[model samples]
Every structure is written in structure tokens, then in C-alpha cells.
Target: MRRMLKQSALVRDNNFKGGLKEYAKEMGKIGKFATQLKIAGYVSIATDIVGSSIKVYEAAPEDKARTTVVETAKVGAGIGFGIYASYLIVGLATGGTGLIVIGIVAAGAAIAAKGTSEIAGYGAGYIYDKVESINE
Candidate 1:
């Protein structure tokens, strides 16, 4: 009985070590991919900014176009900041995990951040519109 217990303990230790080694190797791969993912994210943001600017220019009248452009820029900045802040917070919260795990958590955080920001912006805009109408 004693010999059997010793052998089982040894097996469990070996399995744990093997699993940890595999997890480390996967994390290394995720690290390499993270660089590429970051580059893609930057490109995506630039594309969104340019596209939004073009739409604002085309849609707004001549007198309002500049103001629309500025407002669009503000919105973009807010979204960018929100995403970065959320990412930082989530990264800190998941400090002990691999990049893949961090990415997953950060993505969820970013999505939630974006959604909440949009809702807040819409609510503020609605309130401002109502107040302006009441003043008029």
C-alpha cells in the first residue's frame, strides 16, 4: 500500500510539470502573436478615424462641416481612451495570465467600455437637445 501511494504521488508530480511546461510554450506563441495583433489594432483605429472624418465631411453642410468634424474627433478620442483604460485595468487584474488570456479579458472589457461610453454619450446628447429646445 505504501509503495502504491509513492508511485501515484510521483505520477501526479510528473503530470503537473508536463502540463505547466506545455502552458509555458503556448504562452510564448501567444506573445509573438500579440505584437502582430497590436499592429493590426493601430491600423484599424486609423482606418476608422479616416472613414469617420470622410463621412462627417460629406454628410454635414458647409457651415456645420467643421463643427461636425471636431465633434467626431472628440468621440473618437473618447473611444480610444476608454479602450486603453479598460485594457490597462483588465491587464492588471489578470496579471498572472498568458497574453491570450489577457487578450480575451481585455477584449471583453473594451467591449463593455465602448458600449457604456456610447450609451452615456447618447444620453448626454439627448439631454442637451432637450435643454436647448426648452430654452428656445
Candidate 2:
């Protein structure tokens, strides 16, 4: 009977140890799954942020220039007129109508170039502000 009892206790101890090992293994798998799920969640959020930024950029006025002829013409005319007028005054003081015309044309071209650059800068700033606001 003593030998039988000792054998029973040994069997119980072995079973308990085996169960603990299995539990630990299962917990490890759960931990790995949890970690993967967290990584996936982070990736999803990052994708969403990028998608939203793209949407905002696409919706902006600068991006719309490709499709909006009237707005483009208006901006072109305004910049040309404003910059040409400034340069024309200087050209008139130094030369005649010929120089004034040349100055106007040159100023219009320069303004067109600068206007494009400013629009790009403004678009970038708008996107930055939008993203910052979204994060907040």
C-alpha cells in the first residue's frame, strides 16, 4: 500500500507538471498572437493616416488647378497684371514703350514661376496643418 500510494503521488506530480507546461505553451502562443494583432492595428492606423493625407491633398485648390481652367486663368491673369505693373513703372523710368513691354512680359513670366512655387509651398503648409490637426 505504501508503494502504491507513492506511485499515485508520482503520477499526480507528473500530470501536474505536464499540465503546467502545456498551459505555458498556450499562453506563449496567445502572447505572440496579441503582439501580431497590435502590429496589425498600428499598420492599419498608419495606412489610414496616409490615405487621409492623400485625400486632403487631392481636395486642395492647388491640386484642383489641373481640372479648373477658370481658376487657373484668373490666378495667371492676376499675378501677371500685378507683377507686370510693378516692373513696368521701373522700365518706363529707364527706357521707352519697347522696354516697358519687355519688362511686362518678363515680369509676367517671373510672376507665373513664383506663383507656382508659392502655390506649392501653400499646399504643403496646408497639408502639414491638416495632418497636425488630425493628430491632435
Candidate 3:
């Protein structure tokens, strides 16, 4: 009986150790995935910032009509890029399940970029017209 009890205890010990090893492996995988997600988030945000800056820059008034048209196209491209980046970020962050969240965030970013660009463009144009008028 004593020998049998010892053998059972040993088996239990081994099983426990195996379970712990498996759990550790799973945790390590989770950690790696989380780290990747974090890195992706940072990259997305950086890209968005750059896109927004480009839009803002394009908003500034240009003296030539051709330049203005080119700037408008650039601003549109910037907004489009920002929307795509935001969608990618949200999809990655939520594992592609949160459709509402992705749509809202993407839309919000695009709208914000458009509104900001328009405001800045109008302001710059107003200032330029005022300056030109004053000079004349």
C-alpha cells in the first residue's frame, strides 16, 4: 500500500509540472501577441499624425490656381490615408470583430481631418486676401 501511494503521488507531481509548463508557453505567446499589437498601434498613430500634418500643410493658401488644385488633391489623399490607417489600427486592436468601433473611429478621424483642413484653408485664404487688399 505504501509503495502504491508513493507512485500515485509521483504521477500527480509530474502531471502538475506538465500543466505548468503548458500554461507558461501559452502565456508567452499571449505576451508576444500583445507586444506586436502595441507596436502596430504606435505605428498607426504616427502615420495618422503625419497624414494630418500633410493635410494641414496643404490647407495653406497658394497664389496660383494650379497650386491650389494640387494642394486640394494632396489634402484629399491625406484624409484618405488617415481613414485607412485608423481602420487598420482599430481592426488590429479589436481582432477584427468590432465593426462599429472601427467604423466610428475611422469616420471620426476623416471628419476631423476634413474639418480642420477646411478651417485652416479658409483662415489662410482670408488672411492672404486681406494682405493683398491692404497692399493694393
In terms of TM-score, which candidate is strongest? Answer: 1
- Model 2: clashing residue pairs? none
- Candidate 3's clash total is 0
TM-score-best of 1 and 2 = 1
Which 10-residue window of candidate 3 scores lowest in summed lDDT? 8-17
Looking at candidate 3, what is the lDDT of residue 12?
Answer: 39
Lowest summed lDDT across 10 adjacent residues in model 1 is found at: 7-16
Candidate 3 per-residue C-alpha lDDT over 16-104 given as tens digits, one digit per residue, 9 for 90 to 100: 34444443454455456557645655675567557655655666365464335434554555556555665565554344223345445
Clashes of each: 0, 0, 0
Ranking by TM-score: 1, 3, 2
lDDT of 1 by residue, 1-136 (tens): 5456344433245423445455446546656666665775677567656765676766647435444534464466556665676567446433435455666765665566556546655665566567667988
State every prediction's TM-score relative to the real structure. 0.53, 0.32, 0.36
lDDT of 1 at 25: 68
Report the number of the highest-lDDT candidate: 1
